[model samples]
Target: MVSEEEGKILIRLARKSIESYVKNKSLIDIPEDTPETLKENMGVFTTLNKNGMLRGCIGYPEPIKPLINALVEVAVSAAVNDPRFPPVSESELDDLEIEVSVLTKPELIEVEKPEQYMDKIKIGEDGLIIERGPYRGLLLPQVAVELGWNVEEFLYNTCVKAGLTADCWLFKDVKIYKFSSQIFNE
Candidate 1:
């Protein structure tokens, strides 16, 4: 488990990194105080919003660099690369709320019955990734209540997002994984 102090440091460093990037209009190199040793040890996601509606959400599934460095990349990516929405505008920054979720390693599951998620899954705690037939979709763990979606409904929506049949994940080739995260809004 990460200590509270460590979490706070990451939060501070992450926010600073984003602010620097925005100010420079380019990705800034990770600062010396930012922990580079833990880059590959953490995965990060960024969710941006305005007036409580989603603006952009983007992340990496596995730690590619220390958490702070990853945060810089993700925060910028969420602002610019979320295909679902246009790039975040400077005006939106003042109105925008940012959220950071640091994910744990995902657990793969074999589902004989898809409905099993109701009992086997714990919303708000388990980030989910569903894959089948070259299609895949992922929802950070906190997505459940925000969308009011049950497991099947959640999976179905994910399928739609990935351009697959809702039931496509029922196939033997399908893969499922659940992970947890530490989430906070800025």
Candidate 2:
């Protein structure tokens, strides 16, 4: 778990990012001492809804930058770039709730069948990363319960998204890993 001080800083930085972007449509610079530990294979998600149905959800599967920057970028992306929804109007800002989930680093495994995967994965604890050839994809731990998918099924779907066969993860040089998160929402 992150310390209370760290949590305050993170929340402050995130709210600042939101306010700035929503007001002047500008990006916020990442703060220094933003915790290097939080910047590894982490992700930031913004979950928006209207009348209890999902409106937009967007984020990074890997930490491409500092956590604050990643959060701001992905929040804006979810608000405006989610292909599934129209751009979020300013009026909807109050109704939108941002939920952040930082992921753990995925661990690659060698297995011969789907059954081999079941024993190694924890449905609600381990986030997954899968890579094949030049393609890669990820699923946060929460996705399992949300979709009611078993570990093997989740892996297969992730692989398919990367344009690989369901069993591609079993192939040579294919990579996989798992990570946990410190999740928060508002």
Candidate 3:
């Protein structure tokens, strides 16, 4: 688990990273006293919100890089690279709130039928990932809680996010995975 102080450091780092990117400045250096947990590889998502609405959200679902590095990369990418929104301008930095979610490795759910997957999910606690062939999409755990969606709606939305039909989870080749996250916000 990340200590409160470490979580604060991460949130600050995310904000600084986005600021530097928007201003075309050099990347902020990670502090020498950073904790080992931050140095370890971890999956992370950086979420940008303006006035309580989502501005951009992007993440790595696997622990492919150091936590600090992943945080910086995703923070900048969510600010500028998310296709759902235009690049965030320097002027918008002050109004933007940064949220960082450090994810646990996703575990695939084994089920004979797609409908069985619903029994394994906890609405406010487990993030969902749906995959089939080349298509993949994920919904963070907090999404369902925040949107007031039931289990079926969460699954349907995740499928839609994957560019599949809303009922794609019922298909034979579909795979479902679940994971939790430690979410920190500014």
Candidate 4:
């Protein structure tokens, strides 16, 4: 578990990175005092909200880089590259809330059929990833809690997000993965 102090440090770094990138087209240099726990390879997501609604969110689903570096990269991307919204303007800086979700590596959920997924998935706790062929989609854990989706609904939405039919999860070839996240926000 991340200490509260470390969580705060991560949040501040994400905020600074988003603000810097939005205002000046630059990424903040990593801080000098980053804790060793934060330097470990970890996947991270940065979410930007304005007035309690999603403005932008993006992340690495796999642990490809140090937690701190991935956080900075995704924080900036969430500000400007999320296709669902327009780029955040400098004027919006003060109003944005930054959330950082540090994710556990996703583990494949093995089962003979789709129905078993409900047994493995825990609402408000497990994030979902559905993949088929070249298509894939991930919904963070908080998404289900925030949207109040039950396990099946979560599966349906995740399928649609992967650009597949809503019933695709029922297909035997589909792959499902679950991961948990440590989430904190400003």
Candidate 5:
């Protein structure tokens, strides 16, 4: 678990990375004093919110690189590369509140019936990942709380995000994975 101080460091690093990229098109060098725990290759996402609305969100959902490295990469991507929203502008930096979600590895939820999924899911506590063939989608844990959606709605939306039908989870070939996150924001 990350302490409050560590979380704040992550937020600061993310903001610096975004600002550096926005103003000069360069990634910030990870600070020299970064804590070792913050350097673990954990699954991490950087979210940018402006005036309380989502501006952009992106990250490495898998532990593919050091958390410090992933922070710099995804923070910049969220600022300029999220296709759902336009690139964040330089003026928006001051108003942008940054969030970091460190995710646990997603575990496939095995159940005999689609109805069983509701039993396994824990709304605000669990994130969802839906996959079928080559398509996949992920919805972070806070998404449900922010949108006030129940399990069914969350599952359906994740399927759509994966470019599949809302009921795709009912199919035998589809896969459902659930994960928890350590979330912090500023």
Candidate 6:
């Protein structure tokens, strides 16, 4: 788990990365002596909100890089590369609020039936991932909390997000995974 001070440092790093990108400046460099925790591989998401509305949110669901590096990449991507929204402008930076979520490694949950999976989920705590063959969708833990979704609603939405039918979880082939996160916001 990241300490409060470490979380603050991460938030700062994310902001600096986004700011640097918007201004066309060099990316902020992580010092060689960075904390070991920051250097560890981790999955991270950066969420950008403007005036209480979502601006852009993007993340890596799997741990592919060091935490600090992932933060920088995802921060800039959330600010500029999110396909759902146009690129954020420099003027809009001041109005934007950044939130970072550091994820625990996802654990696959074995179940014989979809309804059985529902019983395993803990609302507002475990983030859900539904996968089958080539399709996959993930909802971060905070998503359920922020949207006030119960387990059923969360499952439905996750399947929908994966481009599957609302009841896709009922299928026997669907794979379910759950993970928790440490969320920090600016």
Give all candidates' CA lDDT scores: 0.74, 0.70, 0.92, 0.93, 0.92, 0.90
Candidate 2 structure, TM-score to reference: 0.75
Ranking of models by TM-score: 4, 3, 5, 6, 1, 2
The per-residue C-alpha lDDT of model 5 at residue 144 equals: 88
TM-score of each: 0.86, 0.75, 0.97, 0.98, 0.97, 0.96
State the lDDT of candidate 3 residue by residue for 107-183, as single tens digits.
Answer: 99899877787798999899999998999999999999999999999999999999999999999889999999999
For 13-92, candidate 1 gives per-residue lDDT tens digits of 55665566666677766666644444456888888888989988888877666677777788888887889898776666
For model 2, how does the per-residue alpha-carbon lDDT over 19-79 read when each residue is reduced to its tens digit? 5777778888777667865554455665556666676777776556656667777777776
Best by lDDT: 4
Q: After superposition, how far is residue 181 of candidate 4 from its true place, in Å?
A: 0.3
Poorly placed runs, candidate 5 (over 4 Å): none
Per-model RMSD to reference: 2.3, 3.4, 1.0, 0.8, 1.0, 1.1
Shift in Å, residue 149, candidate 1: 1.8
Per-candidate total of colliding backbone pairs: 4, 7, 0, 0, 0, 0
Ranking by lDDT: 4, 3, 5, 6, 1, 2
**Alpha-carbon runs more than 4 Å astray in model 2:** 8-12, 29-43, 112-114, 163-173
Please, what are the lDDT tens digits per residue for candidate 5 over residues 1-186?
678899889888899999999989998898899999988888899999888888999987888888889889999999999999989888888999999998888889999988999999999899999999999999999998999999999999999999999999899999999999998888
Stretches > 4 Å off in candidate 1: 35-40
Residue 9 accuracy (lDDT) in model 3: 95
* lDDT, candidate 4, 12-61, per-residue tens: 99999988898789989998889999999999999999999999999999
lDDT of 3: 0.92
